[model samples]
Target chain A: MNENNSNTNLSSVVSNRAWRQSAPWIAGAAMAAFGLSRRSKSGLALAAAGGALAYAGWRANTSESDQFLARGSVLLNCSPQEAYQRYRNFEDLPKFMFHLESVTKIGERQYRWVALGPVGIPIQWDAEIVDERENEFISWRSLPGSELTAAGSVRFEKAPSGRGTILTAITHFDHPAGKLGYAVAKLFGKVPNFVMQQDLRRFKALIEAGEIATTEGQPHGPRSLKAAALKLADPDRPLARSAPMSEILKQQRRTA
Target chain B: MKAVCWMGTNKMSVENVPDPKILNPRDAIVRITSTCICGSDLHLYNGLIPTMEQGDIMGHEFMGEVVETGSAVQPEKLKVGDRVVVPFTIACGRCFFCQQKLWSCCENSNPNYWIAEKMMGYSPSGLFGYTHMMGGYAGGQAQYARVPFADVGPLKIPQGIPDDKVVFLSDIFPTGYFGAVNCDIKRGDTVAIWGCGPVGQFAIRSAFMLGAERVIAIDRFSYRLEMAEQGGAETINYEEVDDVVQTLKDMTANVGPDSCMDAVGMEAHGDNPMYALDRVKQAFKLETDRPIVLRQCIQACRKGGTVSVPGVYSGFADTIPMGAFMNKGLTMKTGQTHMMNFMQPLLQRIEKGEIDPSFVISHRMPIDSAPQMYKTFRDKQDRCTKVVLDPWATATAA
Candidate 1:
């Protein structure tokens, strides 16, 4: 009975796929005839064209054979070395990715990203930089156990209209449930993409807006009050206020 | 895209409008199946509620199936096919209020991000399809609605319970339950519920379920009074009675009720004929002494009794006799219903077949007939207690 059920399921899947592939043509023909009656031949033609375009877009956007193909690109105003300083450090990605609360660098190329999940669940993702080139391109694959396992890349290219670089991100993941999973991923993924995209733009703004990198290669020490104040003003500072003034006052009073 | 819009005072219409879509990752587009004209909506329908814009979608009580959701939304918990009953209030679970379990006042709860602060009052968050001051999120009284904070606001329907039975739980049921809970209704306590509207009816019933020995429901509407009686409440029609407070005190052996629930909220009509003119004038001027019931509740409650107010109040400028309240040593607990906290327990009760709240629903019509239903309900005609609007119905054949 189990074998029969499996066979039935497989056959049904095949039949469904066949029907889906043919549905557009049938719909197009019907729409074309109806469009002619309504003096909307152009509408019918447009409908057919739209269907073709949509199908092509879907195919191009998805992976036919799930061999973990992911691609992404990012544009930056800074040079490759400056961009590499930020991008190479996986732990610091959370600084830009607001949704990502923390990223723990476990190994040279591996990291664990802790992100806020729906209904208060902490979603954890294990990722590894599968491919890396000095500063032009970096690709990573998320390890299994996530709601989704994705492979993506970030590439830096010259901006089409200007001097600043154009950053492009492209990713392809195995959407198991096909349309349903694809739809779900599109919905949820947009938020992180938006945050990351905005961060990239901000990074470009920071670089082009002429921010001096002062802490580079400096020994970790208690920063001066002026330096601390400047650091406090950084938008990337997690907490709005670092330490309470009362605590500072109390410390000063005790020292006195 | 069909929406029941509050055009002006005593003017409302169901008109075609743009379909709502998922504009943010925290948003979900729901194809509304069941939406209802709420009593609070009548405040806008009659232009009593302030800051209402023309073509504003009215009616908040609703249930729908998720058609689309934002990327940040959880598909596992809420999928496209899952049917859900959404609270009137929108809330983002991560916000200050949500972290404190005060989902009704979430900071990031508005659908229109531009009007986030101005959408609702200083309270910050509230129901969809309300006025400009209450999130201005087009209400569920339409073919489609964009539910912000879907994971937090939209609750999954438990299997086996009919839609009508559990529909009231979305707002009134939970509000009433909150009232009973807030009153600290102990087993065998005598409870009094003010105003026998749908909420009052539920409060009376819920008080009984919560172990109130005697639930006295006060109202002038005979039909509502009958509803309360059927729901196991001893009815007191104030129209036929001389003094409702005295009558309630008489029932409670001169000590008054152990607890009193003010279910009337902000738009409660005054019981006295002399006060009716003032009440109408106040309602028109956006100044309401709905607190008369509140004062009555305080006066009618026994010393050390509790008063639970689940009614909506905003832009407060009312003086209650705090000295009298203090002397009486009564506990006053009032706020929005934390529906999420009570949903599971309520769902359990429904699952056990212990409560059937569909008795409040007096009219069920197509969504397009909402304007007519709203008028009927507003006028309190045809004994329309509660009207449920079905969005799937085809527009009336011209």
Candidate 2:
């Protein structure tokens, strides 16, 4: 048990070190893209900064294993208690989490989760909640020998301004297909930070607005660049808004 | 339904497309009675703005009767058969920005908020029929449009007011008023306005209303200048004048105007070599906007004065003269107008006969002629200043 605990501690240190070096590279890339599109003189400077940061990050990650951590935080218009209560309920995750198939409680503090993998394939994992602090935090890790090795924690605390609670979600996972899968997901805009942020936004929407509002199906003004290109391949294919039934039903109830 | 669809750069067609339906709970289906080709729409027609996909319906200034209301729409506020003018800025009133009356910066309205936030540091409110970056909500230039946040944006028109008089309230009128308001014009102040287009004409009038002693309107087009004159402003023909800056300085005792407004946004014309540079760069997608008017506005405003820009700039403008702007201690204010803030007051102005807003309308045509009219309006042909379309009208053969 002591050896296993030391191993987990060593891995956490390595993951933290990787993130400390990589976060700037991610931010720099986003800035460089923005600057280029704006055509500002500063864009070149941003690109240089991004290139340097990416190089530094690559060097830092070369010393570590194929594991990474992504952390995101959002202010919700609710108390810390409420935020913790909702997050502690494993069954409620799929409601606000996209691409999650199901999270079923198996035993005391143990749950089995099914999620959509990279290419629409179903992937399953069993997790056990290792630690939980009431109205504050919950930590969980995938059971040994599971399909995927992952761990995460949800922390809730009052915001500095006293306006509401700040919920921070920290996820640590190994890409199933290793570094290649991670790169592909990042290119396709499903980067860990982006996914976490989106999930937090949906959680905010769900808690504050009762549902995530969408313009899907009803009508859209224009096709996004990628969607427009895809139209060239399948000329007659109809575009969908990609809104799920939960969101549709929520909108229906509001309208009715 | 016959809707105006953007085909490509400098191409448009009145095509038959599927009618818009209520996709959101807060939506309402409006049967468009009248829609106008805005000066900003010319940017889309000229392919100046990016993220414009084929078949994107264009036209932000419009009004019509509410044909259907979603369940979330309050029947007391908006109902079927009720005439209303929808604000071009789509805002969900519950957001933190909206509560402060900054309707254009609403957070929850833009579904494409990620794209907008990627370009701009943060996304503003969604706009009807603008671009994919602004929620990509279908615009009101067709027979029918689905208006999201209908409960917040659509202002009901009282009996006796014609569509022409009230439709401007949707965009240009409020935009011009906001531009003038942003100028912070003091009593007996001189305001110089660029581009005597509809927004400029309204800005000229709105400047006077805000106690500007004189508004010197600049443009290359004589007809638009004439409209500016009709709105009671002195005019400067930049095409005829060698030095617009010297002319404005001479007109203002060499102090320049107290506040200068740029009503012409992305596609500005000037005799300077920089304008040519912008054209070449824009043609090659090297730059997104021609910053001539912004440059001129900063240069022409008095030291420690305001530069109010109601013009829509999609992307970065080159050679902005930041040194001059900083050294002069000039203040700049620019944004998509928060129309909800001024709609009621401006509606009262029209009701009191303070000004006839429809005086700027130069052509009324059927929607079928939208394709040709887009060119005519962009080229400033046939004395056209603004073109209003009757969506249901049968066009006379060309």
Candidate 3:
């Protein structure tokens, strides 16, 4: 899991878009404030650059981009045929993908997806398979009038020297928060490319090692020096995801 | 179980803590019969390495019996009652890095991946009882320690060999051998090494083992220099020398040594103005490491010769003569020892009586006396070179 935390307080699409629209002006005012205080040639140049950025942000917030694409790839230990077969079983995706809820087949070449939003909100969408070549590629796009407008494709190929199969995924979408939503998501480590890479790693672990190794409740990097010192005092005390050894072992066995 | 914990800078205490149990499928519990206070532990003691916690158990080089095993460990490879020396680096064997034999860079071992990625570009393998960025799995300084990825890391020793004879295999011996290996020593090459500490002592012996025709070991301490001499290395007391680099050039007829090794690491000391400058910068947190020895190593090495470093440098180092290094066409090799690669072969070397690594041991004490021994080791008191602790021994006994 990416476990990225957003800094923004506005959760709804309308409020998020409104915040995005105002962000450039806020940055411009801050830059101008500093520039006026300094009152130098470099300061004026910085102020002018900030003004240009503000205007660009204003223009970007006015309309969504035609399409924003995210692409990522991973090398899996499984054969291309096995990898494609497993991917074709869409209902099993939620077993490995933490963000996905369900993919239910509603009709031939059509499906309904219930996915978790930024928070716990449920996002429902309907999509039809635009194209598919068994053991090679698959592509899909959301139907018109759906809550989200997006298209995605995945390609499978044999790795050079027959090391294993290479799985590549491409996703295109138009965000309601406009281009600013991408900026915010990237800042928060929620960039779709990173998420896709992590998801592929998890998938590879499931297909190859049979279990994802974790130190969930164990000691981890400290938030601060003081917290690290406190951890030094009584490290045996569990932190967050403490679980019995047997239960953790059982989880590993289930994956195997 | 009584375990040694780090309280703060230069502060350590043995406390009654719960015994370790298997926490992962590949985990195993080792009842540590012998553990040693490493020279690097002094770095943590002196508060150089960041991310250490207050109650963190703090020993890494250790050996013991496997009293319990997690389900994922194959019974045929590891089992109860096996005497084993566990490497300090934790590796998942299945990771891409592990398959490439870069055990220290294993991708699946370190749990603090995000933090390490932010600091080091990518995470290395998890380490035992070092710091949080290295996975903070409790160390073996206590009566019991949890071993992760047991199938890959721990080397099972034979029944006849004493723990003292084989214990150094976990770190110093392998580290020294790998340091020499990184030098890519050809037969009859001249190798100059900085720092006559334990690792340097081993490096001196290992250079000779690798057929280095001449080895010059440099340090300020008389006892360590004497020990290096005993290991078949020519000694140079830098404190007595007018100019070490000039002296090295004079000794090598101005061509410099074929290969130079910097085992002094981040905490090197010298009276040079640049050393003084680095000291001030390091004190004010402007620089993370003092690179006096490394600078000298680069300046003193022959043009186109290799510089191998086994020193533990935690963060950024300042005042490095990079221009000299580049113009001289020097090749620098350094990494954490891939313990899995060297342990068994080095163990054979120990068993064959070719080298008794125990020459470094100068003090032995109970685990309860670790705090005082830590001070003694750090201060070079009583001519101490290395200190080994018996977890079951009484605190007052020697």
Highest-scoring model, TM-score? 2
Better of 1 and 3 by lDDT: 3
Evaluate residue A108 in candidate 3 and report its C-alpha lDDT on the 0 to 100 scale. 97
Q: What TM-score would you give candidate 3 relative to the actual structure?
A: 0.79
| Residue range A84-185, candidate 3, lDDT tens digits | 998888888776665677999998998888765544456567888877889998877789887667667778999987677999876555554633443323
Please tell me the TM-score of chain A for candidate 1: 0.46
lDDT, residue A222, model 3:
19
What are the per-candidate TM-scores when only chain A is compared? 0.46, 0.62, 0.59
List the global CA lDDT of all models: 0.64, 0.77, 0.76
Candidate 2 regions exceeding 4 Å error are A1-65, A75-92, A105-111, A118-120, A128-136, A160-165, A177-190, A207-213, A219-256
Off by over 4 Å in 1: A1-256, B111-121, B158-160, B271-274, B280-286, B316-319, B395-398
The alpha-carbon deviation from the true structure for residue B232 of candidate 2, after best TM-score superposition, in angstroms, is 1.7
lDDT of 1 at B388: 90
Which candidate wins on DockQ?
2
Off by over 4 Å in 3: A1-8, A11-71, A75-135, A138-151, A159-166, A170-193, A204-210, A219-256, B394-398
lDDT of 3 at B242: 93
Q: Where does candidate 1 chain B have its weakest 10-residue lDDT segment? A: B111-120
Tens digit of per-residue lDDT, candidate 1, span B1-398: 78887666787777777777666566678888788777777766765555455566777888878899878677776888788888887765654356678877654553222232332324456567775445456777888877766777778886666789877767888888888889899898999988888888878878888898999998888898898898889988877888888999788779889998888766665657635654655654534334667777877889999989976654332546677689999999987777887776787788787887788899989987877887899878999899998888875731
Per-residue C-alpha lDDT of model 2 across residues B314-354, encoded as one tens digit per residue: 87778889998999999999899999999999999999999
What residue pairs clash in candidate 2, if any at all? A255-B71
